[model samples]
Target: MIIGLHVQVTVNRPLGSTHPEHHTIQYPLNYGYVAGVIGGDGEPQDAYVLDVATPVRQQTGYVVAIIHRRDDNETKWVVAPKFRFVTEAEVRKATNFQEKYFQDDIWLL
Candidate 1:
């Protein structure tokens, strides 16, 4: 089935000057549709559910792709090897909107 953009990420918190995490990187800032699924319930087909917009790919097998970052100053795609789901957390300390929007859903890692 086709699902929405599964943004599997690991939020590395900010540390001391010497202990700063380099993974603050945003990498691919955007994602696109990969697949879709049939949505429905046991209520005599009340409606078709579009689970495709949900980020469920995190539970499925890993899909290999390339992440090309220029070494010098060139705009191109480079291969960084395959990646899989890890975790996702909203940035809190960096922005106050996280608390304003996410409200009780805000999570810090």
Candidate 2:
């Protein structure tokens, strides 16, 4: 993903939402999918919105990083404020709730 491109995310799972099947896993950040884009999983590309404090149904933001899953074909886009920055560790921690189930790498642009 480009570092500064404004992306529209359609949030299927908003912040504080629980996993559809894994009810115990709560989302700490807004989790969604890029509108009109299909991913390697043959579904809408998944995305995680960071640094934003409130719950949101949808949002537009710049791409900050890409969460590449080594074991799976799907890749998740990390979206955040244009001027904000998050370290690799921070990204890892934020997405760990679900990402921990897969081998992954965080690529910051």
Candidate 3:
């Protein structure tokens, strides 16, 4: 029985190019997965598997949720579900080389 789930994600940022400075910014994001809603068995529901297109439609990246947090001087991994959204188009446009590079994390296809 699956009680919980964990997923890996990647983040990409835009950078200036040409005279300004031809450079690209990339970020590798990681976080624990938590169901947005509860399931019939009283467990958390898994996030519906979506391709890079999902983020493109929203024009946002997936937010990185730091499960570990500090509250009242007590630090522990919290279930805040905080995340950053990514664009599907940006991810889809990624090259196969990049995808294989970040295979452990989010895949670009």
Against the hidden reference, what TM-scores do the models get? 0.18, 0.92, 0.18
For model 3, the stretches where C-alpha displacement exceeds 4 angstroms are 1-27, 35-86, 92-109
What value does the lDDT take at residue 70 in candidate 1? 28
Per-residue accuracy of model 1 over 33-97 as CA lDDT, tens digit each: 21232113211101111112332222222222222222322111111113332222312222222
**TM-score of model 1 relative to the true fold?**
0.18
Using lDDT as the yardstick, the better of models 1 and 3 is 3
Q: Cα lDDT for residue 42, model 2?
A: 95
Measured by lDDT, the strongest candidate is: 2
Give me the candidate number with maximum TM-score: 2
lDDT for each candidate structure = 0.22, 0.88, 0.26
Per-residue C-alpha lDDT of model 3 across residues 4-96, encoded as one tens digit per residue: 223322212211111123234231221122335443335442222233332211122232221111222211111112333434443333322
Spell out the clash pairs found in candidate 2: none
The residue-by-residue lDDT of candidate 2 on 7-69, one tens digit each, is 988888988999999999999999999978899999988999988788898888988888889
